[model samples]
Target: MTLTSKQRAHLRGLSHSLKPTAHVGKDGVTPAVVRSLLETFQQHELVKVRVLENAPDSAKSLAHEIAEKLAGAHVVQTMGRNVTLYRPDPEEPTIALPR
Candidate 1:
C-alpha cells in the first residue's frame, strides 16, 4: 500500500528515536542486507536503517532501492546518514496515521 504524505510524516516522527535496525556498510544493499531489512520490517513496522561512510551510495537513493526491494515498504524520510522505512504490518497494525 502506498502511504500518504501525512502517513509518511507520521512514520518519520515515530522513527526519530529508533536506532538503526540494519546498517548498509561496504556491502551496500546486498541480498543479505535486504533480507535483514525485510525481517526488521516484519518485526517492526517502522525501521531505521543507517548508511555507513563506506557505503558507495547516498542514503536517499539507497533508501529508494531498499523500498523497491521491499514491495509495499516505502521511504518515510532520509536524515543525514539515516533512512526510515515503513511497511504496515498486515497481522497487527501498530501505527495510526493522521487524516
Candidate 2:
C-alpha cells in the first residue's frame, strides 16, 4: 500500500513523540533486526527506527531495507539518524491515515 502526501504528513506528525523501538547497529540490517522490525510492525503498526552512528549504512537505506523485508511496511519519514515506518496491522490498527 502506498501512502498519500497527507497520510505521510500525518504519520510524520505522529512520529514526533515516539521513541525509537529498533536500532540498526554496526551489524546493519541483520535477520535479527528484521525480526525485531516485524514485531514492531505487529505491535505498534507505526514505529520509529534509529540508525546508530556506528551503523553500516544510511538511514534511508535501512528504512528501505526494512520496508522491503516486511510485507506492508513503508518508510514514511527520515531525519538524520532516525527513520519512521508504517505497516497497518489488520487485527488492530491504532493509526488512522488521512485520506
lDDT of 2 by residue, 1-99 (tens): 799999999999988999999999999999999998887677788899999999988999888988998888889999999999999988878888879
Whole-model lDDT, model 1: 0.89
For all candidates, the clash counts are 0, 0
TM-score of 1: 0.92
For model 2, the superposed segments whose C-alpha errors exceed 4 Å read none
Any runs in candidate 1 off by more than 4 Å, and if so which?
none
Model 1 RMSD in Å is 1.2
Q: How high is the lDDT of residue 37 in model 2?
A: 85
| TM-score of each candidate structure, all chains considered together | 0.92, 0.94
The lowest-lDDT stretch of 10 consecutive residues in candidate 1 is 1-10
